[model samples]
Target chain A: MSSKITWPVPDPAAPPEAHPALVSAALSAARAYGEARAEHTRGELAESSRTGADGTATMRVDELVEGAIADTARRHRVNLLSEEVGFVDNASALTMVVDPVDGSNNAASGVPLSCFAGVMVEDGVPTEALTCWLDTGRCWHAIVGEDTAYRTSGRTELDGAALGLLRPHPEIGRSWWHLAERAERVRVLGTTCLEAALVAEGSFDAFVDPGNDAHRIVDLAAALVMVPAAGGVVRDVFDRPLEIDTDLTRRWSGVVAATPELAERIIETVRG
Target chain B: MSSKITWPVPDPAAPPEAHPALVSAALSAARAYGEARAEHTRGELAESSRTGADGTATMRVDELVEGAIADTARRHRVNLLSEEVGFVDNASALTMVVDPVDGSNNAASGVPLSCFAGVMVEDGVPTEALTCWLDTGRCWHAIVGEDTAYRTSGRTELDGAALGLLRPHPEIGRSWWHLAERAERVRVLGTTCLEAALVAEGSFDAFVDPGNDAHRIVDLAAALVMVPAAGGVVRDVFDRPLEIDTDLTRRWSGVVAATPELAERIIETVRG
Candidate 1:
């Protein structure tokens, strides 16, 4: 069963500056939550079979991570919107959207692509975001209009430009053909959250997930904060502006997030 | 243009323990070659998009990796059978099969799903093997019938159980759908060599690649030795034994590497 979350829309008159100290505290909390869950994920993956229908072990890891985040949110006295456990703490100065494990399925099989995502919302707008790639020990963080950075062993901001693209559903089969025709060296990584984080670092130009309705909010919430903070845009398939307050629990079918120019070019390529 | 490699037929009468240290030296040489190439794979991936229609950059990385392995084989005074460069030092005491970087495409995409594979042959029979997942810093190794152990950040041993399935290609549609119907969670990490190593570790039930024809002896060579050494079975989809000596440069149409029983089962699943 699914449920809707209600949020108090921030007033336009509310001050836009969210506390940087609070953002720092949130980042630390997110990192701790991610570290604790990493051990559980490793053990679960080790004991689990790849082909079994019972993904209980995987779910248990997700639940534990979610619980840890929720506990931390309560301790921090922050409202939380989490993928595993929905919204909590209705009225608070800050709101956190958490995805305990973004690539749950991949983590279950010991695939090295899973991550933990967190985004902070202030006054009904995303203010800060962070993500940690579990296996790689890579972390990315962004504060809107302030700074965006990626860190593994040390801190640095990505400078190279890589484009992200979304192929329309109608173009799925023919898309590769078109890619071949355009001589585009494209890669489909299959994890939406990871792609979005890449967009924030300016390492990737765009991210296109045609059906937003299919993926859970845990994947997109952090991306929502990161992309715009890095000067990228996220929109619907028909190229309509996205509303942050929309019910995020459901999939957003046909979404594209990219640099303005690249997004337009990708849409044009698909249309052609 | 494509070429074929010739390998010596295994001589059952030859001493099994012959030239163990030579195999070790060859393995070490292979590792050095792989490590060198891995250092540059990231840069290659960063530059893949800028490559022209002729795929000069892709070919360049392949040639560079292949060249290093050939040089290493020369230095070690061992015969070499490699994926990109084919055969060298044909009549030496130790014949090393090497894949400098498996998952070339993934390595070219910053996917971290690539590895180096090496197998040592004596009298045409694989005697020892080493496979290293470059990104994770995990290595799986086996020397003849001695216990096979996997070395990662944490150490683990294959229980002689579990199947590791590779990519199961559908005759049609997305090659991924084959995994959807299974009771087990399907994992596609995008690197053929790494998947093969997982089979060697007994961490997975089987590895199946139905439609892709990129499985070369050099790619599977190292994993094949480790898997069989760990008491697992490895074979092609036709239930035929994977012949490591056959034209090493050519790729197989489909492969199923697992316990003998699991391999048969997966083949049936593909056929059904």
Candidate 2:
């Protein structure tokens, strides 16, 4: 109500030993988004102020949060690859790929479902990831080579499965409905990184894009490292590699599932 | 996740002067659900423990949370009407109708989108309502006739509107698709009360069930009071009165919209 979010945004609970770039970016993103809400109305926040390098209209809320994160990346001396601002090259092997405010619409609309997701990539290989829910500072961090604090649901079948999915589009609505029909429970949470985190934490059997080609590299950066570490699979429906390409316009339909079997099943189902 | 939600369920931020019965029930529900997550694996928590009074399979997490709320109702000397336990007659004029854990599947599965929603009704009239998000303990409380701290989005047109909705079912899939096609944004969060609370707080333009009669009194108890107080209208698709019916089996397709025009448009769209 009143064109503003009344509740205060909480500080992110980034764990100890998280990459300094990720931690700083998450904190800066949260604080900037919070201040954006306090100062701007919903209309202002949701306004498409400029075209992002990703070939999409960037919302003011996304800009504010991304601006803060870009500053953090510069301070940390890491190359930044983000949704709104594209890549800020520092010519370093270490890169921070992030969705500064995932679920930008939810963030501007005060839906309390937005997140800050970032991954540490070393020489085109993802090393670690962190995802923080902005409304409440719940963090899920995982290193690619190390054990995770979480686990997947270990589900292998589409039947009796619980899934988080993207909303349907006219072109891809069938894919959405098909997976939803097979699953016993379905949720469209409007935040990809958070949904992937839920799958990593064994909350849902999978988080899928359903052939929508809705995810950019920044969108899946965290899931690319985190899900596999948590005993799950991160895949593209068309079997494309999730490479760290600087082309922000490239898209993928990401499927983050609890098990390799389940991920394969989802891919086959989408293909059908 | 090891079958446990590692994050602590926060204490509810219920406003001062909230009804004692509602406050107690919310606190108890959050605590019990948190404890259930700690003790049970996702499978154990999600097991269809029993048939609820609402003619549906109840999860163990729901039972645990409802059990706690039922005890709180008895201590508060109020009649209790909950989904799992049905109605408990305390022979009092005041009745606390509650969905102890609104999103049972999400709660049990650790999706962190469930809530505790309760409405205090006096002689068939809902006097006040409270919705507490279990994972974050954020509360939205509103008195039927009093001014509220929040406001609705005040949107009228379905086109360019944002909505929170129930997931599509085969029987009502067309209706779900129809409104989704018109809306600018769509989310299926799997929790009616929390979606309705978002509608009340201006985070979303509407929360709809399409033509699926998925809501019992307890599912919509809080929205019936809170949404209207925040300048919105709550209606059933079939135009049935949201009366204080003792029959837990009775269902309605709830349409909680930010404005009467938007509510009417949604009903027409579903009907078409």
lDDT of 2 by residue, B29-64 (tens): 888987888888877888885799999998888998
lDDT of 2 at A199: 91
Backbone clashes for every candidate come to 35, 2
lDDT of each: 0.51, 0.91
Task: Write the residue-wise lDDT of candidate 1 on A7-114 in tens digits.
Answer: 111111111243443333334434443444444434443343322111123365466556666767776778877664567775687887767667665444444456
DockQ versus reference, model 2: 0.70
Candidate 2 lDDT over residue span A49-96, tens digit each: 679989999999999999999889888999999887788998789999
Judge candidate 2 at residue B263 and give its lDDT.
Answer: 99
lDDT of 1 by residue, B1-272 (tens): 01111111111111234344333433443444344344543344334333322223334445555566676677767887776556676558778877766766544444455666677887788887766665445556677778754321121212232223343322333432343344244444556677766655433555666645546667667766676675565566554456767465455534434446555555565555
Candidate 1 global lDDT:
0.51
> In model 2, where do residues sit more than 4 Å from their true spots?
none
